[model samples]
Structures are given as structure tokens and as C-alpha cells.
Target: MSNYTVKIKNSAKSDLRKIKHSYLKKSFLEIVETLKNDPYKITQSFEKLEPKYLERYSRRINHQHRVVYTVDDRNKEVLILSAWSHYD
Candidate 1:
């Protein structure tokens, strides 16, 4: 089991900075760590995107917020595209 390197986009970093709640922020970071180990395991709140474009996946940070990312298996990298409230 190889670990993946997680990279956050500039837009995603902007979104993360906008997170006001402490718990949501913590959970989001935790989820990112989990992705480093395994980004393909799908649970209730963690799954691949519907269209499956670019091997993208979504992991919930909380009820409203989620982390959107794409997996690069060959390079073992996870690129975070967004980390913000989905409903917002």
C-alpha cells in the first residue's frame, strides 16, 4: 500500500482559508490525510464523482462542506480542487 502525495490547488487553499468553523477545518484536514493513504475507498460520504471525469472524488468534511479532489494513481498523487461548502 503506497501513500499518495496530497496537493491542494490555489483555489482550494482560498476556500480552506474561508472555513470559519474549527471542527469542519479539522475534519477536512483529517480527510486529506486519509486520502494520502487511500483515495479510492468509497464510503457513505466518500465516493467518486458521478461523471467520473478525471478520476475525481469527493469526501465530506461535514454536513455542508466537502473536499473535491482527483486521484493520479501512476504518480500516487491526490489533487484537491475544492474544500468548501457545497451548498454555498
Candidate 2:
């Protein structure tokens, strides 16, 4: 099996394809960098996370920053579905 995997959720992909209004450009970029540096750590840390939204999930990367995603437990892959500001 592959060591890691990264995927974009269908809804997020669809949203991104139509509108790039820049909700969390920098946050999203940071997530990309984090994933590149160490996908396993993020994935490991996120294994216990539960989705806050109706259809998507999210977890914190550094301090209170969030890394929203859905993971494949079988392959231990981390699929970042979205990113949200920790305001509410």
C-alpha cells in the first residue's frame, strides 16, 4: 500500500472550480506546505477528529488554526476537504 494520500473532496473541488473568492487562501496554502512537509503527522493527529459540519470534517494544525478534511483509515491517507477560521 502507498505510504500516504491527499485528495480534495468533490464538494470542495466543485466549489473551488466555480468560485475562488479567497476565503482562506493563506490558510489553505499553509495546509499544502504542512502536508508536503509531513502528511503522516497531520494524518495521525487527525485520526481521532470528528466532523463538525454536516458533510465535512476539520482539525487544528497549529494552536487554534484548523485543517478540515476526511481521512481514509484503511490506507492512513489524509484528505483535506476544507479550512475554516476558528471564529465560531
Candidate 3:
């Protein structure tokens, strides 16, 4: 059972649609599933993004791209704010 419900914003949905690499898209989906279970669980690239990103957290999809999201513990939700190349 998932402890957190993952919600992707329309902008993030647009970002996913722009991904040309099939494998990278697959990796993004897998990471979303992981977030549903434990949004705070640290992976190789998972890290909190404060000061700059407020309460958001980021997880790398690759050297170029990442998923940026914020977790709402009170409602058990994870809102995906962005899913695209970080340097863009």
C-alpha cells in the first residue's frame, strides 16, 4: 500500500511528453512509484531542495534531468512540480 499519493502537475506532464528518450521516461515512472511509498526516502540522487526551492525535494533521473516535488505529510500527498532537465 502506498503511504503517499503522487500527483503530477500539468507542467510536469508537459515535461514528460517532451522527453525523447524512452528509457528516461521509464525511469521517471519508476521514481514516481517510489515516491508514492516513501517520498522522503533517500535514493542515490534524492535530496531536499530548500532555500532555493522551498519545501521541494529532487530526485535525479539522469545527469541532465530530474523530478522536483513537494511532500504534504498532513494529507499524505506528493505533488510533482517539475520533471525535466534541471539546467533548463
Candidate 4:
């Protein structure tokens, strides 16, 4: 299995700051660490977005939140685009 390097964007960082719940924040971090190791692992629940999102992908964090990202296989990197909530 290939290890992937995870890179979080500024928008995603801002999103993290907005997470008021400690448990949710911790869950997101744990997911990120898992992504860093093997982004394509089925346990991450990674899914490709709709055509409107083009090459973007998403991983569910919980019932209300998701982490949006894109995989760069050539570079072996996972570019985290944003942390999205259903409310916003």
C-alpha cells in the first residue's frame, strides 16, 4: 500500500477553526491521519463528487460534516480542499 501525503488548504483550516465540538474536531483529525496513510482505503468512505465538482472527492466525518478533497496519484498527495457542514 502506498502512503499519501495530506495537505490541508487554508479554507479547510478555517473550517476546522469553526468546529466548536471537541469530539467532531478530534474525529476529523483522526480521519486526516488515516487519509495520510492510505487515501484510497475503503474505511475512509471516500467518494467521488458529482460532475459539477469535477475531480473533487469527499469523505464523511459524521452525519453532518464532510471533508472535501482531491487525490493526486502522481504526486502521492491528498489535497484537502475544505471541511464542509450540511448547514453551510
Candidate 5:
């Protein structure tokens, strides 16, 4: 399989660095893999974008986590914005 190039903001990178649980770390990696496999799932969250946030992409893992990202269509990169444990 080809490698998918993903970009993330500095703040977001710092945020990801703070994750403590090993399980969540594994799940987070899985989420990135899933994004490369199915990008349309990113576009599938149009209805949920908040007023202050740009509605680019999202994914739900199990029932407790959300992975939100900003899509760079020109470069075909998924820039992860922030991850929330619940509706934050």
C-alpha cells in the first residue's frame, strides 16, 4: 500500500503528544490508517461542524472519541485539528 501523507498543525501535534493511554495511542494510529483507506468518511460529517469550527472532516471511534481534521484537498493531506473525548 502507498503511504498517505498527513499534516497536522503545531498545536495539534502538541496535543497528540499529550496522550497517555497506550490503547488510545493504538486507536489513534488506526484512525490515521482508516483515513487513507476511506477519505469520504471525512466528508460525511458536514452536519456536525460547529459555528466556530470549519467542517472539513471527522471520525467516530467506538462511542467515546472523535477525531476532527481539516482537509487540504489540493495536497490531499489530512491535518488533524483536535480530538475530543466527547462532545466538547
Candidate 6:
């Protein structure tokens, strides 16, 4: 069983379906699985957004894509807010 739970917002779900590349989609899914274990632990390209997005965080899916989320420490849940190509 996973230590933390991951929940995707409706907007993020829509964004996920818009990914056109299968390989990219697969990679994003893999990262999300890891997020279920610990959203704050994936430091490769993860960043806590600045003042404008306080309490929210982002992890790179690739050079162009990103997964934005927020962590609820009290409940041990990771709420996925968005998944989209940064340049889009």
C-alpha cells in the first residue's frame, strides 16, 4: 500500500487526456505513481512554486511538460492540479 494518496483534479484529468504522445503520457503516469509515495521527495526537477502559487508545487514530466500539484500534509494526500505542456 502507498503511504500517500494521489488525487487528480478534473482539470488535470482533462489535460492528461490531451497529451498526444504515448511515450510522454506514459512517463507522466510513472511520475504520478511515484508521487503517491511521496510528492515532496521527487527532487530531480520538482519545485515549489513562488508567491503567486503558494503551497503548490510542480514536477517536470519532460523539458516541455509539467505536473502541478499541492500536498495536503495533514491528510497525506497529493492533489494534482494540472498536467500540461509548459509552452502551451
Candidate 1, residue 78: lDDT: 90
TM-score of each: 0.85, 0.45, 0.88, 0.79, 0.66, 0.85
Best by TM-score: 3
Using lDDT as the measure, name the better of candidate 4 and candidate 6: 6
The alpha-carbon deviation from the true structure for residue 62 of candidate 3, after best TM-score superposition, in angstroms, is 0.5
Model 1: colliding residue pairs: none
Off by over 4 Å in 2: 1-3, 14-19, 40-47, 51-57, 60-65, 73-76, 84-88
CA displacement after TM-score superposition, residue 65 of candidate 6 (Å): 0.6
Which digits, one per residue and each the tens of the lDDT, describe model 4 over residues 27-64? Answer: 78878887888776776467878884478877888888
How accurate locally is residue 52 in candidate 5, as Cα lDDT from 0 to 100? 44
Please tell me which predicted candidate would have the highest lDDT against the true structure. Answer: 3
**How many residue pairs clash (N, CA or C atoms closer than 3 angstroms) in each of the candidate models, in the order given?**
0, 0, 0, 0, 0, 0
User: Could you give the candidate ranking by lDDT, starting with the highest?
Assistant: 3, 6, 1, 4, 5, 2
Off by over 4 Å in 3: none
What ranking emerges by TM-score with the best candidate at the front? 3, 6, 1, 4, 5, 2
**Model 6 error, position 79 (Å):** 0.7
Assess each prediction's global lDDT (C-alpha) against the native.
0.82, 0.54, 0.87, 0.79, 0.62, 0.82
Candidate 4 residue runs with Cα over 4 Å from true position: none
- Which candidate, 1 or 5, has the higher TM-score? 1
The RMSD of every model to the true structure, in order and in angstroms, is 2.0, 5.9, 1.9, 2.6, 3.7, 1.9
Deviation (Å) of 32 in candidate 4? 0.7
